[model samples]
Structures are given as C-alpha cells and as structure tokens.
Target: MLDWLITNSWLVWLVLFLLLAIIEMMTLDLLFIMMSSGALVALFTALLGWPFWLQVVVFCVVALMMVLFVRPVALRHLRRGPREQATNVERLIGEQALALETVTDHSGMVKIGGDTWTARSSDGTAIPAGARVAVERIEGATAVVYPAAGPGPFPAQ
Candidate 1:
C-alpha cells in the first residue's frame, strides 16, 4: 500500500489543490488562493517524479513568495476605487430635509429623505416648520440640521 501511494503522489497533490480551491471559495480572501497556486506547483513537481519532501519544500517556498509579494498587489488593485461611496447614514449628510415641526436646539422633528426623524439645530437655534434644512450629522436617532441656503418652501403648483 505504501509503495503504491508513493508512486501515485500526484493524486495527493491534486487533492490538496482541490481542497485549497474549495476553501478559497469559502473564505473569499486571497490567502487560500495563493496556497492553491503552490499546491498546483507541487502537483506539477509530483508529475515530474520529484520526491515528496522536495515537492513540499517547493510548495512552501512558492506559497510564501506569493503571499508576501503577489497578495499585497492583488489586494491593492481589488480595493482601489473612488474613496466616496455614501451608504446608510452617511448618505444623509449634506442632504436636504424639511422641518416638520418647530425644531429647537435640543429636540424637534424633521422630514429627511421622506422619513421623519428627531432633530436638533446645529447652531443651537429654532427652526420653524416647512423650512428647508441640511442634515449635518446623525446623533443616535436624531439628525443634526442647519438652515439650508436657498429658497425656503417649495413653490405651490
């Protein structure tokens, strides 16, 4: 059994490659993919009749080099993009809102993005209803707003 396994070492390397590839899919990180590339090198070495220990050494070297060199480049390219992609509460910043009720420095209500939210004035003042405001930031469940520069109320149809 041992003799037959020694002769069929390529099968072991191929299986290792497949397992690493499956783990890469699950992890979505580049680490496993780099290791799988090493496993592929090991598989080729096995096919070329290299000894098992030498194949493992080659695998280790290749995987280490890829992780130390290639992975950083790949990650940099993958993450490179526009720095601004407003999401969730971040999208509300600088957005216009309508004061639904008298908003004071401490407590009030405003309609932001068509949804009502507790609000406070950024400059600690009172804002009357139907006034246009700009969301400065969100504090807990409240939106901090400032008077928007421009027309106050929308024109009636």
Candidate 2:
C-alpha cells in the first residue's frame, strides 16, 4: 500500500485538496481555501513527477503567500462598503422622548419610541413629566436627555 501511494502521489494531493475545500466551506475564514489552492499547485507538481518533499515545499510557500498577500486584498474588497450600522442601544441616541415621570439629574423615566427607559438629565436639571426631551446619548442602561422644544401651540380646543 505504501509503495502504491509513493508511485501514485497525485491521488494524495487530490484528496488533501478536497479535504481543505470541505473545511473551507465549514469555516468560511479563507484559511483553508488558501491551503486548498496550495494543494492544487502541489497536485500539478506531483503530475509533473516532482518528488514528494519538493511538492510539500511548494505547497507551503504557495499557501503562505496566499495567506499573507491575497487574503488581505480579498478581505478588503469584501468589506468595501459603508461602515457597520449601529445596533441595539446605540440606535437610541438623538431620538426624542416624552418624560414619563419627573426626570431629575439622578433618576427618571421616559417613553422613547414606544419603549419606557430609565433616563437622566443631560444638564443636571429636572424635567417635568409630559415634557419633550431629546436623547443626547446612553450611559449604561440609562438615556441621557435634554429638553426639546415643544410642538407648536395646540389649535384652540
């Protein structure tokens, strides 16, 4: 079996390439894909009657080059777009809210976008309930807010 493998080494390279490709699909990290490219080169070298050791050396050099050079360019191109969108609590900043309770510098509550959140005065002043406020930012679980101009005077009821 060992003698047959030594003589038909291209089969080994082919099997290695397939294994790397399979792992690449599972990981999606581009590392195994680069290794599969090296295995492909080694496969060609084996078909050309190169010694097993020489094929291994070629595979190592090619894989290293791909990882160090090609992978960066590919990742940069793949990531070429607008910066990542803000998520979760970050989306609350700059929104307007209604003070659900008398919001003071130390503690308060506000209804923001249909959700009630703990809030604090941005300028350390009290904001009465039913007042309009703008979210300045978030600190931990709390919304920091400042008084927002009220809506134009209601039409005479």
Scored by CA lDDT, what does every candidate get?
Answer: 0.88, 0.88
> For residue 16, what is the lDDT in candidate 1?
88
* TM-score: model 2 vs. ground truth: 0.53
C-alpha positional error of residue 41 in candidate 2 after TM-score superposition, expressed in Å = 0.2
Put down candidate 1 lDDT per residue, 1-157, tens digits, no spaces.
Answer: 8777778989988998999999999999999999999999999999999998899999999999999999999999887645376567877888788888989999889887668899999999999998888999998899999999997543222
Q: Write model 2 residue lDDT over 94-113, tens digit each, in one string.
A: 77888889999999999888
User: Against the true structure, candidate 2 has what lDDT?
Assistant: 0.88
Clashing pairs in 2: none
In model 1, state the lDDT of residue 17.
92
- For each candidate, how many residue pairs have backbone atoms clashing (under 3 Å)? 0, 0
